[model samples]
Target: MSKANKESLSVGTKIEYRKDFKDIYLPKTMPVIIDVPKMKYVMISGEGDPNGEEFARVSEALFSLSYAVKMSYKSNEVPAGYYEYTVFPLEGIWDLVDKSKPATDKSNLKYTIMIRQPDFLTDELFDRFVKRTKKKKQNPYLEKLTFGEIAEGLCCQIMHVGSFDDEPESFARMEAFCEEEGYVRSDYTHREIYLSDPRKTEVTKLNTVLRFAVRRFR
Candidate 1:
């Protein structure tokens, strides 16, 4: 780690992924194999291009509800395991609507967009935030958001520092790694974690973590 990266880490009261899960979040530009444990998230599902209006609506809804939960902890009541931490980067599980076709086909994509949650987040507490956010925003998309846990298990991952359109090159590295390691890509959607704000960052400078679920060849 660079001196700047190490200097930025605090002793405590941090939810930085780079500090905690360096292998998973701060992966090298080259592919690396890793294990992802089960984790909780606030998620919503949709189909078609991620650049479409529906995707925007869902993204807005997730952020709205997530902030609602944060504010609730700040003012009303902090949960049992509540701690000061950054809201997780937006992530997505992407696949093709037509299973037979390539998952990369942008026009027929299916995705479950999500933001990771703290361990203290409970179903009851999540419900309260949902109700609170709904009352404030009155967005129908809020109803689609749900809380759940997912175990991605073993996988190959890499940091793709370019436009989303360039992810195939990164995935190519992961694919080669899997093939040489005698692993088979699992029947799970490819996962991407956005580390840069697309609205502000240049496409070539976008930082994204790409992961593929995999298991040993059997």
Candidate 2:
């Protein structure tokens, strides 16, 4: 972990990533470049339409583990560096299984859905919580969970508000912005941080942070 992140965890105050790292999680509507720090996450990979039953199961498994860590204070063994904080929102890195397939083909999509973990969560602690959650929750997807870190060095991002299908419009604006700034998207894949729950929120009101790696135009 970076010194700043380590310090944030050791302070014992509630660390809300949304409030602290708003630039990354809650970006402005217009595209901008930012350096995303490395952070640990509990992730599950699967290929299929995100709206399918299997996707829901994978998402549930991630939340089950995240909540276990959040509510660990009530448990007999609190984590070594436990602190009060809201659970991070669900995020996904999306791609297509077949390059020839268009983005509109949901069934051809591949994704790794994940929820970010607090800085204090260690590899050993993650395993303990996973084991504990497995016993408490009967979700088979829990076994597929893996813990790791991701560092998106420099990226262009924008706050996309509206239906998921309308994302291409936002991406077009982002790509245009990159071109104006002498940068270009580094890959076809992109990351989305879902700030609104589709189950409770209206499609037009959904807030998603759309981001992709970028490099200076060579």
Candidate 3:
């Protein structure tokens, strides 16, 4: 069914809560499609954690995303993952593109820094643009220094309880709020800020704030 015809969340303008998706957990490397549980999350935006920024890592994501687009210009699909993504600047400790690797049951599901603009990737124009950054040239991700201009719109957040696999319900709460708010989903991005790392804490009681971005409708 067409999403436009159905009532989606209003995002920022008229915030409320709803069950927008059956599953919301996005795999690090691929798009998620399944009957997943729902969880809580809130959406908002502004200057976030700056002192602890990761730059070199971001640069790597930019380069990697560029490479992926360039490689998949002819077809509509990519090798193991999907094309085009919406990325957001998340708070707390974060990993950069180069160093930010996603490890799990799927090895290829690594996080890649990418821009949503599709025109920038076409081989019909910028094929050579993707080749210059050889493996040796890629720089390691380093802590970013947030000094100046930082602009962000909306973010969806929710206090997550338990494991990452069990977070769809909380997200539904946030999505419903977005719809009632009249805020359009910018297709901006989804960021999971780690307040407590599960690796170090009890799996039964992990804390995280899943957030997304949005903007008020004109």
Top lDDT hit: 2
lDDT (0-100) at residue 57 of candidate 2? Answer: 93
Models 1 onward score TM values of: 0.89, 0.93, 0.36
Where is the poorest 10-residue window by lDDT in model 2?
1-10
User: Please, what is the whole-model Cα lDDT of each candidate in the order they appear?
Assistant: 0.84, 0.92, 0.39
- lDDT by residue for model 3 over 39-95, one digit each (tens)? 211111223222224433554444453444444423433323223333322233222
TM-score of 2: 0.93
RMSD of each: 6.4, 4.7, 18.0
List the candidate 1 regions with Cα displacement exceeding 4 Å. Answer: 1-12, 100-104
Decide which is better by lDDT, 2 or 3.
2
Q: Residue 131 deviation, candidate 3, in Å? A: 27
List the candidates ranked by lDDT, beginning with the highest.
2, 1, 3
For candidate 1, write residues 1-218 as lDDT tens digits: 34543334333566777688777778889887798999999999989989888898999999998887665544535565665577788999998899888756777999999998878899998998899899889678999899999988898899999899888888888899889888878866799999999999999999999998888984
